[model samples]
Target chain A: MTMKLWYWPEIQGRGEFIRLALEAAGIAYEDCARVSGADALIADLDARKGRAPFAPPYLDIDGFTIAQVADILLYLGDRHDLAPSRIADRYWVHQLQLTIADLVAEVHNVHHPVAVMDYYDDQKPEAARAARQFREERLPKFLDYFEQAAECNDGPWMIDHRWTYADTSLFQLIEGLRYAFPRRMATLTPDYPALARIHGLVADLPGIRQYLASNRRIAFNEQGIFRHYPELDDE
Target chain B: MTMKLWYWPEIQGRGEFIRLALEAAGIAYEDCARVSGADALIADLDARKGRAPFAPPYLDIDGFTIAQVADILLYLGDRHDLAPSRIADRYWVHQLQLTIADLVAEVHNVHHPVAVMDYYDDQKPEAARAARQFREERLPKFLDYFEQAAECNDGPWMIDHRWTYADTSLFQLIEGLRYAFPRRMATLTPDYPALARIHGLVADLPGIRQYLASNRRIAFNEQGIFRHYPELDDE
Candidate 1:
């Protein structure tokens, strides 16, 4: 049976990460929320037996469910033959993924600076200040860091020419940043040539192209993490 | 030979979490920065090659160093027999640890809403708004989560009265919160009695007592992750 994945159906949020990777790899899994409702997702979590994922974006393999975006992807990477074979390379793969997770947290904080529970509307006053700092300082700083990592590789992707979970994650980061901070990303897009090159290259992969075009991938919107607020953008 | 730990010399910062656990476990390790200097800490990290720790507070073991606070603690937890032996129990250890990592990031952000690179004085205006929301909403919400987890066990520690790294990290979290927002924590402290219980209990541990009294443990000063700004604290 295909694995059952549960999260909010309406928005991609963190769950989309699992969705995108699963779809890209052509792995069989059910996005439980989309099939049923958020209630089903809750029931699934409540029904988990031992050491289940703390929250959604979890993968239920056989009967075990795992959480943490990087951990989940690493699990899938190993299962579906996405990760490198060597132990050291796998460790580096996870390290790169953790860096991606770091950027994801920062992206969310652009609008919800102090608390995640509060709406961007509630935090709008703070978001303006955060957005300015993010666009001017954060986006470039993070991009530069990733760009350096990419340069560490002999070619494209985080580790050599072959794609790893980190590459897909970096691709997601690029797409999300472009969506959230288009004006700012536009200004710095050409600067991160390696990242820009990988951005274009990942789309050429058969699985990624299918995933991007399919309805499985939710379009970027205000409800999601990388919501583009024009006022928060600058050249 | 004792393991060599590298981190900033002056501040407890992230290093204290590891330091406390090691000290509490009666494990011996040398503080690399104190014996050497601040430059040595930087030099150690600079000299580390290939997908090493992103920054300081890394431990040098068998010629290999790893970073990330949670990862580092987990490393010591396994080696020092601090973590659970069972895989399932250990997963819970990591899950709770990851959650604590979230709170740590939030604690740091109370003062660095704009950027950590910028001075707190420069970001004080931004920090005020961030700290207000943090104290009013985030702190209690996060503490409530930890309190619930603490209640999962029968006793004071996170898991079955065992003095795991989670307990030590929780101690630091509580201490940091108090230092950062004394008046706010004073008003809110009563609500998280479980966490406070755990806090007081961990402090009384023999190793913790010795470490606290000894110069080995760094003090809570303004330069660390937790800093008290009177203007940002209120009932």
Candidate 2:
């Protein structure tokens, strides 16, 4: 089966979740935009008629395109055995992924509190206040929720003994948080041992290890969602 | 079959989307929190172990609980034929619902830009700035996407000739946007005729018409995600 993933060629952003899943599952898919340039991605997106993606990070499987990180992950989890076998468990995994998506959106809003169209430099004061709330409240709350979810099962994985796409996404979420707010994360990391354990487990996976070391993984930068602005990080 | 929905009893928040679908489909459901109280909803949510909802607006069908507005809608769409019959169309409807959820989050943020936990009075200036950006850029972009989606099919609904859960949710989104940013919506609403048509179509559905007139429909208030703060609305 030929599968193609389209996203911004530069930043990890939301596409990283899809990439991590495909990599962890050992699924073979082409990164379309990365190979063909952003212009190709734009042209491809614009050319589509009905039922197109609202933004980047969409996967074209055989001919069908699936957009939205959680939606794409749901499809991947079901097809590649990244999710559980039971229907309820599968929906549970999707719920966890949706929650993770929520936290990710808030993380982006931390740096772009006032508006996405405006530059971070223009909204530094607002970002500072948002960062304080995110660091003190939102980050810990989301981490605590994930920690509870991880603890629900006997194993370190979010669902059963095996790792699901949620685990992989959670791993990326922790990595992004650490990168964006090192000072605050350093203080909070110790509190989420289950999450940290999952992070380590996902990293240790053969596929993930190979992908992270390879050039496929884009480095998080100011243009991406989890940007490290020192003024926005606090302990 | 017994279905119960748990959300804040007071406000027509995210839960309303689920409520709209259920109502539009003529599916019988108990407004659990509204009937019992907010404490009952809290206790029910807190009682769930492993694979629980992260927040309110979760639907308990039989005994299985489903959370996340989009996930809940997807389930309802399948069970009650509120979505398209085709798998691809169903996923398309889901993608649209998720985008609506994104815009809804932004609308909430417009009122509480700095922090969700903090009072709007404390962050009026930040909210003012956020509202301007939301009104100017994000709002139109989202509406344009939805308009295009609605236009893709030869009907007012998002998918095809028949209305899907996406149509119901889109109706709610337009209502919320109008409530939150009256002047801005007034200026922008005419541009997206497709969305306006969908909004009217969803409202006129027999089930929706009855529900809206019934006491089950919670009135929009300052406490809900969509609030009419005159200061935040501008043309």
Candidate 3:
């Protein structure tokens, strides 16, 4: 049976990370929410119990369900043999994935500074301060960390020449930053040579190449993780 | 050969999760930075080249290293047979661990709201707002989620009569919450009976019980994730 993935019907959101991996591996799965609507997604999530997911972007396989972006990615990696073989190396790959998760959380926080319950407009003033710090401090720190990771091996992927989950995640990170802070990303891109190279390489991958061109790969819009606001994108 | 774990010299920081797991498993590992000083951590971290850990609480087993708290716990769990035998069950345990990590990050943010780089004093106003929201919304949301997770199973553990990594993490979360928000935690404790039971159960594990009583488990302080500020804990 095909696994069911439930996420936002329109934007990629956190689900894109899992979708990209499934696509890259040539795996077959139903994009349940995207195929239907948000109502179906909510119903499916609500139907689950005992061991149900805490939030959305959950994957249903057999009788079990799982959530958390990193958890999903790691589970897929292990099942597909897409992660590192050596235990220690696998640990490192997961470490990178967790760090990526942390970055994604912080990226969301920049807009929802006061609380997730508050709107971007309500927290815009606080977001201005938070975004400045994110653009100045975290973006650079996270980008540099990925840059260093890419440089670990001679080729573009984080682990040796083969593409791992971190490569796809790094690609998303670069893409999100570029979409969210065009001017700032333009200024910062030149510094992270290895990260840029990895991003470019991921785009050139046969599976990623096909997926990006298809309608399945949604556009980066304001509703997505990366939002473009001129004020938030200062160089 | 034994593993080498490096973290802060004092307080049960994020690194303590790794330390607790290692101790519970009766694994022999060196606490490098604790034996040395903070300088050792800086040098070891800085000396790492490409694909290095983003921060501390990294374990070096032979030449390979790993970072990220939940990732570390899961990796060690897998290697040590500290997880459930079934794939789906193990996945649930991981999902729970990631949730704890999420809560841990939120707990840290209550004290550092404006910018992680900015001083605590500089971010007091923002932190106060954040703490209010966190206490009112986030803490219960997280605690309720964990309570549900614990209640899913029949026993005290997250899984079927096994002390998985999630149990250990919840124990740490309780300790951290108690240290950081005593009054708030006291009022909130009765609301999460399952989680409180698991916390109390974890304290009874031979290894964990010994670890808590021993001098190895450092006391929580202002420098750690949980800090007691009378103003921060008021209901």
| Best model number under lDDT | 2
For model 2, residues A1-235, the per-residue Cα lDDT tens digits are: 7689999999999999999999998999999989999999999999987778989889998789899998888777767899989878887888898999999999998988888788999999988999999999888888889999899888778898898999999999999999999999999989989999999999999999999999999999999999999989988
TM-score of chain A of each: 0.94, 0.98, 0.97
Stronger candidate by lDDT (1 vs 3): 3
Give residue B63's error in model 3 in angstroms. Answer: 2.1
Once superposed on the true structure, which residue ranges of model 2 sit more than 4 Å away at CA?
none
Q: Give, for candidate 2 chain B, the lowest lDDT window spanning 10 residues.
A: B154-163
* Candidate 3, B145-189: lDDT as tens digits: 888878889876888887887788888899889889888898999
lDDT of 1 by residue, A1-235 (tens): 8987888887868877777677667788888888899898889777755355556777777776677676677667767877888765665676677667777888888888755677878777778877887777777777877787787778677786687777778788888888888888888988899998887777777888987888877788888887889877888
Candidate 2: clashing pairs of residues: none
- Which regions in candidate 1 have their CA more than 4 angstroms from the true location? A39-55, A60-65, A74-82, A121-125, A154-156, A160-162, B43-49, B78-80, B154-156, B190-193
Q: Order the numbered candidates by DockQ, best leading.
A: 2, 3, 1
lDDT of 1 by residue, B14-88 (tens): 888889888889988899898898998888776755556666778877676666677676667667888877665
Better of 1 and 3 by DockQ: 3
Q: Which 10-residue window of candidate 1 chain A scores lowest in summed lDDT? A: A48-57
Relative to the true structure, candidate 3 has a C-alpha RMSD (angstroms) of: 1.7
The top-ranked prediction according to TM-score is 2
